[model samples]
Target: LDRRSTFAAEVCGCQVEIGAAGAMGAAAVVEAAGGTALQACDAAATVFQNIMGSVCDLVQGIVEIPCHSRNAALASMAFLCADM
Candidate 1:
């Protein structure tokens, strides 16, 4: 357990979300930080529109191929969406 790290984010994504969780969580954070719900939904929808994880991406029971980059990229994308 010590090997894993912890974060202090406003909200966190879950395993069920797979690919777009980061962006969605980021949107939630923005909303929690005073952004409107519409903004958050727009941000999450934007990120989801860009990239979405799928079961087809799984390989050998591992879904690590693009999740790392996808999550990071999408998380940042949410901010742009919220701003717009």
Candidate 2:
């Protein structure tokens, strides 16, 4: 998450906090479920691919608008991955 936040800030100029949490947490859950390293990474990458740019760039440019809900959805994904 730290690396992702740094890279996104330096390169993409965005926070991407929830995204990092969702992807990394999902990967951790997959690995905890006995998946191979590659499989875990793939699952996390799939989650990122699905949600990376979904609700960002809102007209208001404040995180409170869509970010909270997006974070909730990401948290749900994390729990779902854990369950799997």
Q: After superposition, which runs of candidate 1 have C-alpha atoms over 4 Å from their true positions?
A: 1-18, 53-63
Give the clash count for each candidate. Answer: 0, 0
lDDT of 2 by residue, 18-40 (tens): 66778788888888788888877
Off by over 4 Å in 2: 1-15, 57-62, 79-84
Best by lDDT: 2
TM-score per prediction, in order, is 0.50, 0.66
lDDT score for residue 44 of model 1: 69
* Model 1, span 1-84: residue lDDT tens: 113422322133222343345556758777878987777877767666655333334556655654565566666766666666
Report the C-alpha displacement of residue 14, candidate 1, in angstroms.
12
Q: Global lDDT of each model?
A: 0.56, 0.67
Q: Tell me how far the alpha carbon of residue 78 in candidate 1 is from the true structure, in angstroms, after superposition.
A: 2.6
lDDT of 1 at 68: 64
